[model samples]
Target: MSQDQSSVSRRNFLTGTGAALAGTAAGLVGHSLFFRPSSAGAVKQGFEWPWPYTELDPEKVRKKGHAGYYDGDCAEGALYALVSELQENVGAPYTYLPVQIMGFGGGGVAGWCTLCGALNGACAAISLTSKDFYKLSSELVAWYCETPFPSHTSNELAKNGEFLVNKSNKVFKQTVSNSPLCHVSVCKWCKENECGSGCPDRSERCARMVGDVVAKTAEILNAYHFGEFRAQCSESDLAHSCQACHSKESPYEMGGWSRGKMDCTSCHIKGHASLVDPHHPGK
Candidate 1:
């Protein structure tokens, strides 16, 4: 009867209704262990950032720093920024969380270049949102295998590979060459020289290659995440393997390890060396 009592009752009713709706939606959608339903409706419906809305305190945001730019601390500033933008614009929640997790875990920097970061991010998001991680991952891999990225095409040249290259020539080619460092400028040069190590134009091409790789990587990721190719590669055994290997130590660091320590080179040798296994001390 009283104004305060009426307001409290109305709030309680809304809260209860929202919870019921979320539960029903989760069940209908098939739950994923990676994604937990939130009490917040809009946030739970994949329209905003995956973080809990109620937990988004200003102090916390500030402490976390820029929503979506690359931060050296986690190499996920850009991802966070993208998620924040999605939250502001489309209100999709948890859509990018899986990507953020994988990226931060060192998956983003791996040389596979087979899947763009955006595609990987989207896949991660799906994994998080699906009810069964294994099943969903498998489905995603199957989808991606059939619908290859533009770079994956064979006759196109400039755009026919898992990773795109940019040079004055605008030509694209895919090969099993090693990826250069993450520097944008260096990547440009490598792309121009076709990943050659001794060409005179190598330096210039390398610089541009760096920029091209970063830009292309960002572009592909965005497309895969938002475009119709959402089903590409439901379960990536390669990604899964990378995740497992990197969980111990990055290949970069392992490269310089002494014989006493684990040597990635021992297993993944290139050219002739790869044909012969370096004898393990015990074996």
Candidate 2:
């Protein structure tokens, strides 16, 4: 072809490509605008701090929690079970929640063995739905420490093939950790059951524990929603006694060195000889 004819063809191709690109960009912009909510505030209100909550069935949540454990481990499972239920029942903001955000909490946060993942997930769910997050979360930790793991209800469900997922159908032994630490909880259970932490029996035990935690969380939320929630547990007498001298408000300067409501005996002995005596100087 002649040089002039070839140049004209090249120009035409460039023009057509530019037009197509412009059209595609415009279509994308329009698509986004079309899907935008008509009233941003209306939708935003649902996501306001401490999202709205409604009563949920403990049994239903328990089943979901058990199933979620198989898929996302403890933390994700616990949070997903509650938030997914809310997503179905209440819709909107609940639907927008990324339920897997707490997945890192599994095995006490990347296997560091800190707080139990089940409790971590349930606490996040509580924070999302309740204004009294701290109080309710404390109650949850206390209940976990004091209440036996693999509640009778969960064991019965497992035995009867009623749980959503049944990795193991054995009725496992139950034990109280007397502490919320994941390492403590798992080690105690493993020691009592005579099984390794990685064993299927332990996995089943954790799954059942997730169910119990989620069910209890649902119950607490339900009670609070109905204005019937009461503090079922509180700081142990030992904790209170230790805090009297060491808490933030302690009158003695040496007494105000530590704080928190967790059981003191869980990680510390009843008494320490190394502790400084406020009454005696340099003793």
Candidate 3:
């Protein structure tokens, strides 16, 4: 529950900290359908970082992580998806850290539902592998915002997963979630896709997105291990235009905060007009 300031790795202070998701039962459908997650599950006495890192197949991880989502939780799905692969390949810390610890990150801690739990899983991956977590996290987040997602399609669960949705008929209608917040991202996708933003489906969408995040994170870690990881997006790749007009740098600043290559409407709902309309000036 507490740690000394000198100790650096703050996986202890992460999103899913309690025993498991609250207000949920403790059985097969209790929450941790895969593994029983406790706040103390992943933590060991005098635990320290620079934890062992292994490179698993990114494409393989994409498949497994998505299936993990079907195990009934987003963060857990991503965690088991990638971590299990690492355990299969080269096992140690993977054996140590349980994927169940991430169960509370769906929406937000304890189902309060804020930041996308998929992103939380990615953060966990960063926390486990890299001391430069912020650098990797920042870049990963920017890419998430920029890319239209649930970017990949899913049909079958096997290694040679079948493609159900052809290029012609729509299956997953993708949307770019400018912010990492779960509700915003998933809701926007539903609206854009004309799916009407319902249950299981929205949950399904986030679950798939979890696959993308986890698999991409695997690629990042794999490349980092192989001397191929490069940070291509940062302060410059983020929102220079929006910041110029709305950030403190501008005389027209709206006391603006946060920076990224996201849509202008990701935040401003009413007080300000949206820059996203097709008829807008930029278009």
Candidate 4:
């Protein structure tokens, strides 16, 4: 063949190959975007706990005063206690023999809002550690102590009278017995404004609701021994509080420790920057 012809032919072949490769790449990219695995509910599903119990030591937990239906290092102590009780009551393979307790710095604004610490802890524990949804559900119900709340209650548990009574007189009595005086004042005001004359005892009502929720949460934790509940509760509450507090301002908006406009990572990283340092400059 002529030299010019040979050169032309070689150029054509190279161009064709390059175009084919480019087409293949484009097709792959298109397929990935259009037919990628659907993760629409990933976050919702991810928030669920995966197991019946965590793996932590019961003896050590008790020694540390971490046993009971509401005793932990901080905000979710009730969750820790519940789990400890679960270990004692449930026993055996389900108890997470050598429990692995997770840590929480403290309960944030949510605790102040009167949310039950044990419920928060239980939510955290399930979301972060459990793999089996049924087991997680069972554990949650057990922690709470009353029958599983309606939506997920099974025929068996419910038939056995495990159904939670939304307005139990017994719970009301307990609440009245345990309510703080401050709560009583708030209840009185709420009653006078919301229910003119025949307001059911407000303080007792509030106490009952709070106690029922807390007691139920503790009951669920009683079926597991690991401290996953504490860890998750602490992290979840902090995450929620941080998000709420930082949403309104920008890092530079308000001065002084209030990096009002800063994103969570930016501020939290700074706060925990010295976590590992023995002689951190800030410390």
Best by TM-score: 2
Give Cα-based local distance difference scores for all models.
0.34, 0.83, 0.65, 0.35
Displacement of residue 254 (Cα, Å) in model 3 is: 10
TM-score of 1: 0.30
Instruction: Write down the worst ten-residue block by lDDT for model 3.
Output: 158-167
Q: Least lDDT summed over 10 consecutive residues: which range in candidate 2?
A: 27-36
Query: Where does model 3 exceed 4 Å of error?
Result: 1-48, 153-170, 234-238, 241-264, 273-283
Give candidate 1 regions above 4 Å deviation. Answer: 1-102, 105-120, 142-169, 175-193, 196-283
The C-alpha stretches of model 2 lying farther than 4 A from their native spots are: 1-46, 270-283
Every candidate's CA RMSD: 15.7, 16.2, 10.3, 20.8
The CA lDDT at 204 in model 4 is 25
Give the count of colliding residue pairs in each prediction. 55, 2, 0, 37
**Candidate 4 C-alpha RMSD relative to the actual structure:** 20.8
Ranking by lDDT: 2, 3, 4, 1
Predictions ranked by TM-score, top down?
2, 3, 1, 4
| lDDT accuracy of residue 63 in candidate 3 | 66
TM-score of 4: 0.26
- lDDT string for model 4 (121-220, tens) is 4455444334333355444433333222211222232234343322222221121211112223234435443632224443223322223443444333
lDDT of 2 by residue, 1-283 (tens): 2323445443343355445554433322221322333453334233355677888999999999999999999999999999999999889778888988999999999999999999999999998887578788888988888999899999999999999887777888899998999999999999999999999899889999999999999999999888698989877887777677668666656666677678877887624423544343212
Pitting candidate 1 against candidate 3, the one with the higher lDDT is 3
- Report how far off residue 178 is in candidate 1 (Å): 15
